[model samples]
Target: MRWWQCRLAAAVALLAAVLALGAAGPRSPAPLRFAPGGRFKLALFADLHYGENAWTDWGPAQDDASDRVMAAVLDAENPDFVVYLGDLVTANNVPVANASLYWDRAISPARRRGVPWSTVFGNHDDMPFEWPPEWFSPAGVPPVHCPPAASAMPEPDPGCIFRGTPRVELMTAELDRACGLSRSSVGPRELWPGVSNYVLQVLSHEKPHDPALLMYFLDSGGGSYPEVVSCAQVTWFHSQSRFLNPDGRIPELVFWHVPSTAYVKVAPKATSEVRKPCVGSLNEEDVAPQVAEWGMMDALAHRPSVKAIFVGHNHGLDWCCPYEKLWLCFARHTGHGGYGDWPRGARIVEVAEKKHFSVNSWIRMENGSTHSHVTLSSARFS
Candidate 1:
């Protein structure tokens, strides 16, 4: 029964323990669990709002700062693409000049990275101006009956000529301005020729079994003014939505400049005064109807294919309330470039397996050089 038997039993026990640890070794750190095969990464930043008078002085510097931060981020993450959700410029009633500068600066970084970039229109980009009266004096009266040529129109009109009183003169002026005559020699002639709005289709590098994605970039006009959707653009959007075949799968991503729903309401600060619902003001009444008319709520409610909507009008970070299956996110503005007290920042979005996504917000430090990244997992929706 003996000493040899006892030693044999101890040896067996030791071998069993070693085997157990070996079996569990591969599982220790846990495999990267993603949503089935859906695994890809992308970066998103919205409401850069470049070119405000205050920040104009530092526009180039801020652009360089943002460019550096974004370059570092893109180099580190190596996302598939990048998206800017609008308000690229602070229109400031100078859409022609200011928007051009903003676009150049705001996009210079992404362009430098050699990455594909897309965007939607924000309210600020659509800043409007009134038309001079001579454009519309009724026929048979005189040469005045003919709409004033673009050269003759006044500058600094308070209202949007396109949708305000004196509709005829305004419409003509809009045509002239859009045709690249008013602010000639600046801005992209094609882009400035008409209201900028369009749909973009993004395909994945992976196979059909892999996660497929498409982004719909809508032009939500600007401010609170009502502008009819042009017949051509509407038809085009409808066609794009219907025809997109993402590896034979539906669109998995939808991006826009404005929230489909009113995600934020003013909980007035103690010192703030009540104000009327105006075209440019941010109030319940002004925002609510705009949200409705654009059919944003309805589109979001029914479009199961749309996994998310990213926007940036409010300039503050926000996540969807009630937590729907869809994810909604707001990116901080970079317009401060290097001027404002608010930290300039951008967002990084990671789309993982099973339709799961994560957002990490980055803020430009006070030094106006470095960016501090903050994980926004709290805002992550399944």
Candidate 2:
């Protein structure tokens, strides 16, 4: 072949390679931007508790009711994003596959609306029903379960239990396949093992990667395990927060399933004069822990940019209470599959992109009534 022909063929091959790379290039996760006028509204639907009972009519009926509640809120709010604050399914009572079915039902509303959403694991999320109920232990006592070696026994020993995949695996896989919405953009690695602990950045209008506001999702351990945010999880939060906001100029909001110890303190007086009745339950059993100061609450308190922390473990307790400089708020229980017969609703968080970052929140019931409106600003924080 002539030298010119050889050069021409090489050039064509290089061009083809470049085109292929461009076509199959990685799609960067789209950053959630502020809406016009710097306003972004997020709907938090907590404790959807899908698949409360797999083999019973009563459980399915409740799931349908919960579906109605989710549909109503999605239609009413039309939020930019939605966060499912854990307890997505009562996994312990149902098989792993059936539990995933419930996870699908719960996220359908958001998926249909084209709204981006994320989730943080609740205590009961991935718990195997095989684990004994008594293992959760009575008040103030940590759960005592069979040792890890017992899981290796081949025979059906009453004392031996089998744990296959981690609880978050199937649901995370289903979400990745079905809706492609609930998967975390943050970590599936050892740094945040066995849970969904990640961060989502709300970018500014001016810059692509420049974050205006941050959203942190942590896994507060639960189910066969005790309901506590481990020290390692707290360390992960601090590490991620520093990486995301080096100068601490950006504001943030944290989401998880279980409420903190400070929650009990502010919950009693949490009511809105402008909104309707705050009807719900707040028993001692619903609270997470005051037995030990885990430093998560204190860590948040020390961070000036952390505006508030939101949770949804107690299906009955829904209120926004002031704790330290930040607000510890409960998402109005929106599930019928769980223990409550109270009115179901979701919490709406609106963050403004003004000179100083500020926030306003309220509850929207299935009937479209708005309640518990509160505004948090630098002025209020101090």
The C-alpha lDDT values of all candidates are: 0.46, 0.73
Q: Distance from true position, residue 271, model 2, in Å? A: 12
| Error at 196, model 1, angstroms | 4.8
The estimated TM-scores of all candidates read 0.53, 0.79
Which window of 10 residues has the lowest lDDT sum in candidate 1?
276-285
RMSD (CA, Å), candidate 1 to true, equals 20.4
Model 2: which residue pairs collide? 123-222
lDDT tens digits by residue: candidate 1, 20-133: 989876332111122334544556666665544322345445555566656655666665566766666555423232234345556656666655555555666556433335
Error of 1 at 7 (Å): 91
- Could you list the CA RMSD of all candidates, in the order they appear? 20.4, 7.8
- The pairs that clash in candidate 1 are 34-353, 35-353, 35-354, 135-148
